[model samples]
Target: MNFFHGQETLSVIEWILRSVVTFFFLLFAVKVMGSRAISQLRLLDFVMALMLGNIIAHPLSDHRIGLKGSVISTIVIIILYLFGIFLNLKWTWLRNTIETMPIPLIKEGDIIYKGLKKARISIDLLLAELRKEKIADVKKVALAMWESDGKISIFLDPQYEAITPSTYQLETELFDLPRTIIKEGKIDFQALKQINKEEGWLVNELKNHHQTELNRVLLATVDYKHNLNVFLY
Candidate 1:
């Protein structure tokens, strides 16, 4: 009891206990929030994160502050956040109000200064984002949108796009992902079974083709054509 909510003074063990309990509780809270909150921070997620951090931080630092109130407050906030997400899905007006529409940062190779002002981003930041997308020249971009998640979506002009096999009407092989048959000098029996191969065949193939022992090989993958690729340690 003292470990959770201390009296006048807390022992080191009590402090550690409080930290461990709070850590796991926060993990459970985050799990309830879902993966979207971690992957992409929207308006609701941002607010929830800030509030939860602030509420939980005080109890961890001050022994006088009990964990019970913070836990209750976190649960209530999480419920409200989930409710907000549900409302956003049900009501179009609420969704539009909370999650702002994508603003056009660039149109027809021209920079939209008004859009930049509205997005509250500087020209240098825009250029930095463009550089990240390997787009050095702004004139090469057909359209660039400022996404709600604070990411820039850039599309190159048709003329600036890279040429592919389809451009010349060339035939191409079908996509075939390689399966890992062995990793870290150990065979993955499941992957071998999926490819309709046995352990003996893999050993023989490695010996005959690569002249390498199974334990010596770091990684081995087999493609759709049964082509064995091996990497050594």
Candidate 2:
């Protein structure tokens, strides 16, 4: 009985050790891989990570390289990922620290070469990219940002700031949002409530516009100018 109990305790201890080591190793590997490993990751990066995980998981899980050990390691990795996601949602600072922040690559129309270099972006390539967008002059750019997700966002200098207002034509109307009255062949009752409108209002408007049936209408929306635009067929 004594020998049996000792064996049981040792088994439990071994499992605990395996779990702890596997968790830490996976965590470190993911972090060291950098934000780009997951964000804007290429096909090769994803494949390599998957292959490495499969190979490394075995020894970490059961102290042996086998299918069962690989399964255990995969489970550990999933748990770690879930835990990290939870913490990221709960802690803003942690999320910010782990994730990349948008860096200002251009400030006051001046390119910050150091920032671009740190991001592994070439100044000549960036300038060429801007030119493709019809932005020929860097002096006309108010701000340029290298987003965390590996996308660049360019903010052009305001019309009046970059060029005189008189040089451009003025538009009389403000940009407006389109309203949806129906979706997926079903009436969106919640949308009607939010818009402070009823089903009767939609029916009457459609009828007034000579639209016979709701099913016949593929899409009906109120444009920014408060004009109803309908599409069918």
Candidate 3:
């Protein structure tokens, strides 16, 4: 427990214990912050992440620095972060201020130079982002926005958009996600039960259709239509 607080010296085991505790504490903190903090790093999220990392990192490197202070500071920061998120939800102005409004970088096939300056992104960076989105020509973009999360959202002109089944009024089958019945040479009995299948039936199917033994299968999936797909080891 002394290792958790400021100590003159620490054993190898104490150091290991301290690291394990810090790792789990950080995991718990991140869990409390929610998926938004991990996925979309807005202004508030960015600040929280930066502060938490700095606070936790110091104690791990120096034995004199205590884990207790870092943990307490992290908890306080998380609470403030949650409160800030709540305020953002309750007030539109605060949300707009903290998150900021999306700046239009391109509109109607024309680049807005003012938006480029406001977003503080160069034309080369914008072109690089466009390339990542598979838009080779600027003229093909109907709208391009610089999001508050530091990501650029690009919408291609309808004429240049990829043709889909709806474009031709074509009929399509209902969506059905295949359930994994077997993985890594092991049968998922729960998945089998979900599809109203038996172990014996699956083994027999593998023998008859796939012409391979059950253990030889690396992965197997069954669709809504009971179409068994198998990949061998």
Candidate 4:
């Protein structure tokens, strides 16, 4: 019987061969398409991806498409995608024509109503993303932009920023990043090393906070000033 012959039941050999071919083709296609296929996916690209998946799914899941027909269709889609990628890279005009540019949502601490309407994003959603950046007051923001990926990028006014003693020529503690000491009832020895702290110091600190049992501690972190903050479970 022909390999591509209509059959109600799929043999192990047929399944294996078809799977390998489809998997490799998809892998190669994605690699060529770049991370944009998986990350920061624009709406058009997202729809195109769903269509490609539908095309490939017929042969793998349903027997509507035979191996030969599926492979050829898949190849055509991949090649067309590759040509689009080529155009995107080589032609600046084409790239701009296909992709959306960053839109300004806020300027000088004031919302640009026209821009908000053009972006098709609501004021509530914009404020939500700004709050995530630890911005309590919108007036403190100098500019807010809606990125191409639909995320907001906030720029704070210099006057509202945290004052550094050094900026005014005063003394200040050395800056450092916080390190997690414990998380989810588990001790993190690596974090202790990151803060240049010993396990004994960690144990004593835990005890000082009335948390002698590491398992009972929900979360702990060494702050920028080296102060240990413990959260109990």
Candidate 5:
């Protein structure tokens, strides 16, 4: 029993050591490869990562890299890499779709309430992220966008006179009535009235904005100059 326990303990220690080595190796490779592998995430980068993992996984394991496994793995990685390249070239939308859009954490001097809700993030969390970028004041942020690969972009407001409404119109894209206006436990009556600028406006507006239940909106505001801000629970 003592001998058996000793052998088991040794096995566990060996496993732990192997895991540590594998982790460090991968970490080193990632560091050498740079941030683009995660940020841009091109087909080449993805395939290289998979191949790198497989290459490292083999040496760590008890099994040797046979001629067949080596050739097959290489071919599979190559095929995947080629396919990704083809997709990127053939379909621009495919690449665009795969890449995440900049999420609006804040819009037009207001912390986009609905955006945070959609992202399942909290105000404090968003503030913490902004603080990392040396941004303490929410008012200072004109456009705080969450980037493609888990990056936050804080666009500070330019120190200039506000442009004319005509300039605003030129700069903005005219959109129809908002779909989901009231969000994140807040009211957007102004937004409701704006769209339903007629009789029974409140009821119709509420219906359009899907405010059948008043308690649903966590935050709601509208800046027709840009986009409707909403946050729902």
Candidate 6:
């Protein structure tokens, strides 16, 4: 019996199985890492991709190792990483330890030099970020935070925000959040009650708008201005 006779056939089968596993598991591993890895590309995300890629390569090139061992090791690492992420999300202490919170770079028109230094953000860089947010003066910024994902969130002083209908000291009623009273030709009586409107009142109002039947109304909402918007199917 030739020593290598049947071994070649076995090697071909092994290669096919390993190829399929490696190809699919790479995608699975990335998904397990989470979507933030794609959108944010935070430090942890980059490290995971690099590490998983390295682990997958060694087994592909070396036929001496069983394909299952390498894949299993990769899965173990992913599981551990995911557990750490879950802890960071659920536990406050672990969250702070694993990922830093948004640092307050500016407060009440004063630059927090201490915070800027801690975040390793220079004055020039901070100014550049401010400019991107279209803030011309730091004095106009009521608050500015350096977000963990490497972006800046700016809250303008009430006076600095753009003029609106009520910006010029004009008296305005309190804004009430709108609620749907009708949706898809069905009356939401529960929503009407939540808005302090009686079912009979809604029917009467709908009649005023020439909408006699709830089944004919496609959409309706009562907004902060006490205005009823109704649309027919």
lDDT of 3 by residue, 83-175 (tens): 999999999999988887999999989999999999999999999999998889999999999999999999999999999999999999999
Ordered from best to worst TM-score, the candidate numbers read 3, 1, 4, 6, 2, 5
Which stretches of model 6 miss by more than 4 angstroms?
1-23, 42-46, 57-70, 164-233
Note the Cα lDDT for every prediction shown. Answer: 0.92, 0.67, 0.95, 0.79, 0.60, 0.78
Task: Name the lDDT of candidate 1.
Answer: 0.92
lDDT for each residue of candidate 4 in 108-214, tens digit (9 for 90 to 100) = 98999988998999989888888899998888899998876677888999998887776789876676777888998777888778778887788888788665678
* Pairs with steric clashes in candidate 6: none
Residue lDDT tens for model 5, 141-219:
8888876655677787875335666765666556555444455544455655666543354335445765554466566
Please name the candidate that would achieve the greatest TM-score relative to the true structure.
3
- Per-model TM-score, in order, reads 0.91, 0.49, 0.97, 0.62, 0.45, 0.55
Error of 4 at 118 (Å): 1.2
Task: Supply the global lDDT for candidate 6.
Answer: 0.78
Candidate 3, lDDT over the whole model: 0.95
Ranking by lDDT: 3, 1, 4, 6, 2, 5
Model 6: number of clashes? 0
Better of 2 and 4 by lDDT: 4
Question: Candidate 3: which stretches are off by over 4 Å?
Answer: none
Better of 1 and 4 by TM-score: 1
Between prediction 1 and prediction 6, the one with superior lDDT is: 1
Which RMSD values do the candidates have, in order? 1.9, 10.7, 1.0, 6.2, 21.7, 9.0
